[model samples]
Target chain A: MKIMHCPLNGPRNISEFAYGGQVEVMPDPHQCSDKDWASYVFYEKNAIGVVKEWWQHSPSSYWFIAERHNASDDILRTYDPSELFSERVDFTTGENEP
Target chain B: MTTGLVSPKRCADSHGDRHNDGLKLHDLSLATRSGVRGVKASEWLIAQSLHQELKTHELQPPELQPNTLVELPGSRLLMALSTREFWLLEPETEAQASPIPSGHCAPGVWPLYNQNSHAWLVLSGEPRAEMMAKLCGVDLRIEAFPVGTVAQTQMALASVVIAHHLWRDEAVFSLFVDQSLADFAWEALQDAMEEFNSVQ
Candidate 1:
């Protein structure tokens, strides 16, 4: 079984995680045209180079960013969402209630 | 307490139900479990003075010690499930029925949820380590996962929060599965153990 190193939980089996979609900033709704908004929602560059994307550790429901090469499927690096922000785990999905 | 699925009515001790080699499987449903969950929850627990109170008396709940399963003086078991979460097992003073006694919890620190989230189970016996090997990938051997070690991991196809605890000098593995999948997980566990019993 392939293992992915979780920044917080150490190396874990790939089965323990889910691939979150490509990480791209949402276009500014007020400034972007409707056509641009539509493209942003449905498109992915799918560039052959490395791109940052979200991956969730399902057991803990913790979200983290993974930089991977699209063409090679190589994970260049993985880290917690907090590394790039002040918030800890992304609470956006709200599946886990406090 | 005399309530819920794990209530006194449906709960039972090991019931002398030992596997072929004297392995004990007990219903932990009656044990009061509270989720001290969310990221940075240990800090919130510290702020509430529960950690201090436990520490002041030198009663180290499993999380505080480097060991995998240390029991407290009051038998309050703390299983730090993740970097940001923990589940307290056998809580001596469970107050989830009432408010958190104002001034105990501050805004945004980390909120505490009642007992609606998890279903509890315990795997106790001499062969538990061998049995656990068949169920999940994370190493449960004493040297690797130790006593105080806790984690949110996949077990028998369920996302479970597991904490190793010691009861009566015997190794005990406490499982906290999401309430929704509790029954399925428990059933899977039984089947997993059945094969071992038949073989032995």
Candidate 2:
């Protein structure tokens, strides 16, 4: 069985992980066009080269990021999301508007 | 504090041979356990513990690292699931009070419903790791997962937190799983332990 290294729990069976879609910049829901919002939620780059993606360790329910090659199916490196996200994102919505 | 709590695994107490080299299983669901989680959970717990120590004039417990278990006063076990999540376990003590609802215990620390949401099971014996191999993927041998080690992994297709620590000087594996799956996990463990039953 294949093994995948988790940012929290070390290497575990591939079965213990669920592949989340590739990491992408989100368009502001209230500021961006409807088309842009839909594309951001439904679409992926799906390129052939190495890309960053989100992965969850089912047992611990921990989510982290992983760099992997699409064609070779090789995991380049894995790390905690804190490395990329330094601050929390706050969305200004109609209900919370001052 | 006595809440007259009952364990989900009724057969746990009746089972298990605690003698050295004998495979045993005990159900500790009725034991006292509580948890906290949040970015400031660790800091808050440490502060609270220190406050209690001062009030009682007792020594405070040591610092805990991720995936590690530390012994505390009154036979309590402090297990760190992550830097921000921790479980305080009193395996020998029965539940006295009702579970606290989910809410802020401190500024950024929130209480967990683990006392009510999870069942506790403990396994002991010389070949405990071998028995676990039948149901789990992690290496649980004492050398690999030494005493005081904690692992959050899957056993018998169910999520479980396994803590290896010394109980009364004897090594044991303490498992925590969802209360709803207590019987299933217990039965699965019993089945894997059948071969060692004769050794007891």
Which candidate leads the pack in DockQ? 2
lDDT for predicted candidate 1 compared with the true structure: 0.66
Once model 2 is optimally superposed onto the true structure by TM-score, how far is the C-alpha of residue B30 displaced, in angstroms?
Answer: 0.6
User: TM per model?
Assistant: 0.77, 0.88
Per-prediction DockQ comes to: 0.45, 0.73
Report the poorest 10 consecutive residues by lDDT, candidate 2 chain B. B6-15
Structural similarity of chain A in candidate 2, as TM-score: 0.90
Q: Any idea what lDDT model 2 has?
A: 0.81
Candidate 1 wrong stretches, greater than 4 Å: A28-41, A87-98, B1-21, B38-40, B54-70, B91-105, B110-114, B198-200
Writing each residue's lDDT as its tens digit, candidate 1 over B99-196 gives 44223244443544536567677777656777777888888888887776776678986888777777556667877788888778777777666656
- Model 2 DockQ, alpha carbons vs. true complex: 0.73
TM-score of chain B taken alone, candidate 1: 0.73
Alpha-carbon local distance difference test for all models: 0.66, 0.81
Candidate 1 chain B: worst-modelled 10 consecutive residues by lDDT? B10-19
